[model samples]
Target: MKEQFAVDVLICGAGAAGLMLAIDLARRGISFRLIEKAAQPFHGSRGKGIQPRTQEIFEDIGILDRIVAAGGVYPPERLYHNDGSYSDADVMERGKPTSAEPYHLPLMVPQFLTERVMRERLMELGQIPEFSCELVDFVQDADGVTAQLAGKGGEETLRVRWLVGADGGRSLVRHSLGIGFPGKTLGVRALVVDAVITGLSRDYWHRFNDGDMTRQISLCPLAGTHLFQIQGPVPLEGDIELTAEALTTLVAQRTGRDDIQVQSLSWTSLYTMNARLADHYRMDRVFLVGDAAHIHPPTGGQGLNTSVQDAYNLGWKLAAVIQGAPEALLDSYEQERRPVAASMLGLATRLLEAQKHGNMRRGREVHQLDIGYPESTLSQEQPERLDGLSAGDRAPDALIRGAAGHPSRLFNLYKGPHWTLLGYGLDRDAVPSRAGLHIHTFGPHGDVIDEQGHFYEAYEPAMGDWILVRPDGYVGAIVTHENLHALERYLLQVGLGVPGVFNG
Candidate 1:
């Protein structure tokens, strides 16, 4: 028999972006249905790393530490050269040093493990995905969206106020919107292998090159087998075809790992330099996210991270709008995230192009981010004016003293969807206050709170001051040591059920 279930949002494709968005929305009591064609979570880690920015978001949602526990933690960034001597770059220093910590270096975990942790969190929230369900067709009206879905038994119709296509590179929602995703197809194909190796160096990311372009290898340290991605322009000797066997041979030849056998083949796939972006990120009531919005060259390992960040960026907007926030708030999702996506795609493409053209310096420069969030139209607003800043940028992770002087990560306070204000230097103590907002104080001495909260004793925010953090862990808007009208403005502008008057 056919089924009919109505939700505020209908999410297609239960991948990382889809599932994360689902879990986040579920936490807010926002009704949503996440559909995945897969019977269960795919085995093996697809992506091998999670950036610090993403970790901050995960921490905000209250499951990052759990993710670290479930999927083994990856160390720092390490790059190896053919000279036998390896010099590593500090990823934590990749961009401008914000007063945050986690944004410096990303954590290493495969995409499958990420899915596992996210799914576990979803289960905890009582919103498991609607597995085996595939999106068939969808139509949007002024009021809502009606989508056709198919699964094991039959077809069902779900009426939702919004539609999110997290379906990956070949997104049907993108096609339905008639948005163009023009990308060049790289003629080269590379093989990726993930396995446990004991003897290999254990820094972070290691790469082996021929000192030229003959071959290149990227070694990512995972729980067991260091996930290795080896790529080079094909044709070793003569008219040779690029195949899995050829890649295996190349891996053996490059890493000098002919003896280090792969323990368990978690994931293997062929990848090409697909540099493309959708002409539009949003169309009417249906929006696109993750791989559906853009595909970048895998130079900086930003694919999965970018997708997850996209979920963080859009999830709140969708939930807020559905809960009666101004529709203009929803429109800002595309406005803010699209620019960041374009920037990442361009940066990744530049890195790939520099590598392909043998410009190592250019590749390194493009891979690094000295500045951020300002290039976008949404970036012009400062953390000063609004009660809160735009929710589109990456949030930072901070270390703080929790209630009772327990040390904790600043991201910990953002575990729920609420306006959390952190104050210091007040004559008194810190706790939730009169405005229904969650308020806390970290005194002069910073102490560790829980296991998830690690006090590094280094790199702490300015003490004896007030800081207002959003539920997603970003600094929404901050005021000097006192409560101001900015809080009310922030609540009305970015909060649920605010008035947004659109001029046009």
Candidate 2:
């Protein structure tokens, strides 16, 4: 007889995506079990760059401050030639923070550190991921899913309402479901290592390549640590051991400098650039997220950022459905995330090609700030001639005055796991009143007074306009006060209950 447990959701693999989804669910008072095959958390610097858009997601989840404290801006690049000469310049574009976008620059924190921060947040919510727990198999039915899990002690059965596969590139959930991950694996192979090194300036990301640009290597100093991440190509026929001695020799040979010594090694792996997306993100009650749903090159820093977005997009939907919203809500997860994953793959492939051709200057494309679902089924924009904020766009933040006459921001009101209704230039009490819904006015004598007209300008709404911001921070619907019922109908369509009544 196997020990049995039940949970709302069973999340396999405790990586960035898994932990992020776990944190989101935990914060929403949802019961979930985050299981990892490994005995402990991962320790790697593979996905080190967190994009600006992901930072906003982190802010909503209450982990952005910790992430910002643990990481720093990406440093300028120092290019090295075979002749032993080097030049320093900013390789990745940098941007300053603004009122609309607080995290404008990409942050550099090791993947392990990011996971740690997420796990910490999860613990605060009274949930701890089950490490060393492997999912052996699962069977789903119309009701729920029963998953077989194995640990060092014994095997157990977990009955879960839904199963999520965040299990990485070779996802067993996707394989079991017969989802095709068809993509060509590029011939390029690279060795990644994290090691403590000396004689290298920590101020810049050091890159070395031959004159023809065929073979290249880079040693980037990781923020908040004394270690540097060493990336170099691996020969097709040579030994690819991750031992300290092997990495030391590779760094010396690639950089043409014997002075810089790899004193200690922590983590290393051989990675092949493979761009693949699961044919589908959902099959009944089971679903795939992060690397389980898509795998692509790390160029443009899209891999982890896209993975985080996957969890962010799906987390609220899952929570809402479990709370009796609607089963159809889960379908939108695939509809929204799959296209984003495909687009990210294309962007990563293009950036990888640019790198292959010696163009390393990454611009705004890699920032991932512009990625949104303007065509999603959940987006509802009634006005035909729209110029500014519309349905399916990211909800930008703006400074305003709170009801107490104190300075505040839109993001502060939109931070929780509930729908937000913003009635621009309308009566403060005209919005609907209901559970799981927060209403605010953005004009005179309202809860939020736009002193600088920031909300009006950002949303570009006429008088009596209203924008429905979803829990995930995307504009779900935009309409006028006259068509408030249309907003309620849209909410019902998206598995949300209509507010009980309108109060003026």
User: TM-score for every candidate vs. truth?
Assistant: 0.76, 0.95
Q: What lDDT score is found at residue 442 in candidate 1?
A: 46
In the range 1-504, model 1's lDDT, one tens digit per residue, is 533448889999898899889987888788888998777767655665666567666777778777677555445555556666766555433444443454555455777777888898899999898888999999888888889999998998888888999998989889988999986765445555555444455656566663445576665666543454334454323444344455456667777767544444445555655778888888889889999999876666678878887787788777766665567777767776777777787777766666665333322233222223433333322234443223323344556555575665656666776656655444333432433256655444433332333322321334444555545545555454444454545555655213332110
Q: What C-alpha lDDT does candidate 1 achieve relative to the native structure? A: 0.64
Q: What is the C-alpha local distance difference test score of each model?
A: 0.64, 0.84
Residue 80 error, candidate 2, Å? 1.6
Whole-model lDDT, model 2: 0.84
What lDDT does candidate 2 reach at residue 488? Answer: 70
What lDDT does candidate 1 reach at residue 8? 87
Model 2 residue pairs with clashes: none
Any runs in candidate 1 off by more than 4 Å, and if so which?
1-5, 70-99, 183-188, 195-207, 218-221, 224-248, 252-265, 353-409, 422-436, 440-468, 478-487, 496-504
Across residues 382-450, which tens digit of lDDT does each residue of candidate 2 receive?
A: 664357777888898888888788998889999978788888788856754677788888666677788
- Looking at candidate 1, the ten consecutive residues that score lowest on lDDT are 495-504
**Residue 4 error, candidate 2, Å:** 12
